[model samples]
Each structure stands twice: as structure tokens, then as C-alpha cells.
Target: MSTAASEPEETTVKQADQTETPLESLASICTVLAIGLFVMTFIFQNYKIPSGSMEKTLLIGDHVLVDRTSFAPPTKWAPFVHYRDIHRGDVIVFYKPNPETPDLFLVKRAIGIPGDRIHLVNGIVYLNGVAQNEPQAGKPVEDGNPQHAFDAYRDDFPSVPPPPYEIQPLGITASWALDLPNHIQNGDLVVPPGMVFAMGDNRTESEDGRYWGFVPRQNIVGRPLFVYWSFETSADQMSKTSLGDRLSFIGHILVHFFDETRWRRTFHIIR
Candidate 1:
């Protein structure tokens, strides 16, 4: 009877070990999955451009790696510590209107901070009543200009004749139906205490704060540190790669593969 009882006890112990093996495996998997999700949420993230609104500075099809912890504190564990403060002219990424698509990120330059009065005169941008001198504004190119020849051609050859031109008769000046410059005159649209005004470099084509209003500080994700990679949208048009073109590609590729990249724009401290 004693030998029979010991056999049953040993069998029970073996069954418990078999059950514990799966439990241990499950625990390991859960731990790994949790860690992966946490890292993805807080450490770094990737964003893809969806529009030409920030053209010349950013373009469609360009994928950027955004450092999510650049400005905000890492998680809630340490609340008092801030990584960095937002500055004027910093190219920042932010959340868009759609809730279903969280990956839709918009990149724009921070123009107005709290308490700033932004305005526009004619075609120039002004901050706090003073006209901002942006040396980077490459030759005031019109929207859908010669560069976008395809769009121009499509517009000109629409299936239906466009609507009749409306004349908004001003006392001395007659306003015909034509594209107008998006300029703000006098408006006390004060950027709330914890909000900012953002604008794309492609002023004419951008749907920015000028359209949808200010961006809350909480919406900002991160500042773009460097251009890890860049491919010219116009490169494919070339017939054959010249020595100069080959050199350019080699340099760009090297930057793309190795270094902080953006050879010409590398180490270019964001102002």
C-alpha cells in the first residue's frame, strides 16, 4: 500500500510540471510582446509624407524616422523632466484630424508661439506686426506652375467648360475669377497659451493654421533632426546619368546608407 501511494504522488508531481511548462512559455511571450509594444509607443516611430503641402522641405513618398521622446518626457514615470522646448522655425510632426488613422503625420514649421500676433501682407508673412525675412523662400513660385505641367494641362483640358467667371466688382478694382493669394490682414486670433501656429514652406498650397487654426501643444510629436535619406523627385527625368549625376547619386546613397545623411544638409542645426 505504501509503494502504491508513492507512485500516485510522483505521477501528480509530473503532471504539475507539464502544466507549468506551457504557463512559463506563455509568460515569456507576454513579456516580450509587452516590451515590443512599449518600445514602439514611446521610443521611436516612422512617418510617411502624404502630401506636397510641405514641399521643397518635405515631399510625398519620403519616409521619416521621428524620435518621439525628443521634446516630451519619457513615459509618466518622470514627470518633472522635459527633454527640450519647442522653438520657432522647428520642423515638427503632429497628429492630423482623423482618429482612425493615427499614422497620418503632418510636418510643418512652427511659426507662432503663445501670445504671438501673426499676419500676412500681400504675399509676405509677418509675425507680431513685423515682416519675417525668410531667406529660404526660393523665388516666389506660383502654385501649379510650369513644374506641375501635368496638372496645368489637365485643368486646361477639362471635359466640361469651367463655370462662368464671376466678377466681384469693387469700387475701383474689378476682381475676376482667379486664384488669390492667401494673406491675412488684421485678426486677433491669439494662439492659446498651450498652442502653436504651424505653416508649410509651400505657402500657397499648404492647408495649415491659416485654414484649420492653431495646433495644440499636446499634438506635437517630434522635431525632425536630420534627413537620413532623400531622393529627388526629378531624378528619373534625366536621360543618362552623367559623371556629375553619378557622383551625386553615390554621395546621396552613401549618406542614405551610412552617416547622419543629408551631406549638404547634414549637421545643419535646425534654427
Candidate 2:
């Protein structure tokens, strides 16, 4: 009688330890996925560096994760979260602030904030009458190399009025060309309220604020936090928009993923 009683208790324990049913497992997976989707949609987002505008700092194919909460407006729901206004020198991702490219997003470093006076001399940024020491900023070497030769209009900035759009080598938009003059005061470009002056680290290659216009505060997105992954990619690869080209690139990535990946840049923090 005692042995039989013990056997029934062992059977009960085994039944209780049985694995979850298929439906239960599926539900668990869905719950996890929903949480992950929420986090990615609201808290963090990822962006890829498609151009060399921010070269040396952010290379082409560098995939970075951006924190969306830092520069976002305060909300009572998440009062505990820390939020702050964008500061000078912060790398920002924002809409191009151009009617022609309304949907385009560009990444650049904030050089001027509201009320700040800005100018450039020989490609060096002069913020509020003092030359900023920006070690990351890149300019073409003055070795008479025509391809990398300096441009007086780009290097000198507002000091040299942008040439007519028809003959302009620099990518200065016509609207910006007209509006840029209104902001200049005593040779300094005064940033108006709710506007930011931004430029790429690679000054020679970037078509940034000098080319377009001030980034509206409303158009400002969050700053990048770190490079999650990077792979060797061509500068013009992003221009190929065909379905076949995208699929071909996907195949190439799969084949060369291990070898082509920039392992050193993985998880590299963005300043």
C-alpha cells in the first residue's frame, strides 16, 4: 500500500514538469517579439552611414544605434527619463530642411546653436569669434591635387558670396544662397532662434548647412550612440535602387560577411 501511494505522487510530479504546449510556446514568442518591437520603435532606432560625408569618424557602411529619448520633448509618462536640449558639437541626424528633399535625412555635427555667431576661415570653424579646435574636421590637403583641391567659397564660407547656382561647383541650394545673406551680421552668420547650423566632419566632401540651410529645431532627430556593425561598402552603392541590385547586394553581403565586416568598428562609440 505504501509503495503504490509513493508511485502516484511521483507520477503527479512528472505531469507538473511536462514542457509547455505548442500554443503556449508560440504565445511566449509573440510576447517577446512585441516587447522588442516596442523598444526599437520608441526608445532606439538604427541608421546606416551611406556616404563618406562624416568620413574617418563615421565611415560608409557603419551601422549606428540612435537614442531617441535624449533630445525628445519631455513627457509626463516617462518623467524619470533624462532629456536635454541639443548642444554644440553634438552629432545629429535630421531632415535636410529643403523643400526639394523633404524626406531626406542627413547626419552632421551641430556647429552653432540659437544666438551663436558662426563663420569659417580656410575650413576652420569660427564659433562666436573664437576658432573652434575640431580635430575631427577634415579638409583637402593643399598640394595642388586638383581632385582634392580647396575651394575658396567652401573654405572661406560666408565671407565669399556663393556664386550663381548655374555655375556653382559647391552644392549650394538657390534658396539657401538667398537666405544665407540675411543671417550674416558683421561677417558672422548669426543662428536664428529655433535653428541650428550643422556641417559634416569631412568639410570638403560634405554638402551640409553651407549647401542647404539651417536645420530647424523641429526637424532635429536623436544623436547616434554607437556603431553596432560595419562592413566594406562602396560610396556609390546606395545609389543603386533597383530590386535586382538590392538582392544582388544582399547575396554579396551573405557571402563576404565574415571577411568584409569591419570587426574593429563593431560597437565603436560615436562621439
lDDT of candidate 2? 0.91
List all candidate RMSDs to the true structure.
11.9, 1.9
Which residue pairs in model 1 clash with each other? none
Error of 2 at 162 (Å): 1.6
lDDT of each: 0.60, 0.91
Q: Which stretches of candidate 2 lie over 4 Å from their true place?
A: 2-19, 144-147
Candidate 1 lDDT by residue in tens digits, 81-100 = 56876787888988753345
> Model 1, stretches more than 4 Å misplaced?
1-36, 73-82, 97-103, 138-188, 231-271
Collision count of model 1: 0
For model 2, residues 1-271, the per-residue Cα lDDT tens digits are 9998899899989998797889999999999999999888888989999999998899999999988889989999999989999899999988889998898878899999999998888899999999989889997687776645777878888899999989987778999988989999999999999999999998888889988889999898789999999999999999999999999999999999999999999999999
Please give the RMSD of candidate 2 to the true structure.
Answer: 1.9
Give the Cα error of residue 232 in candidate 2, in Å: 0.7
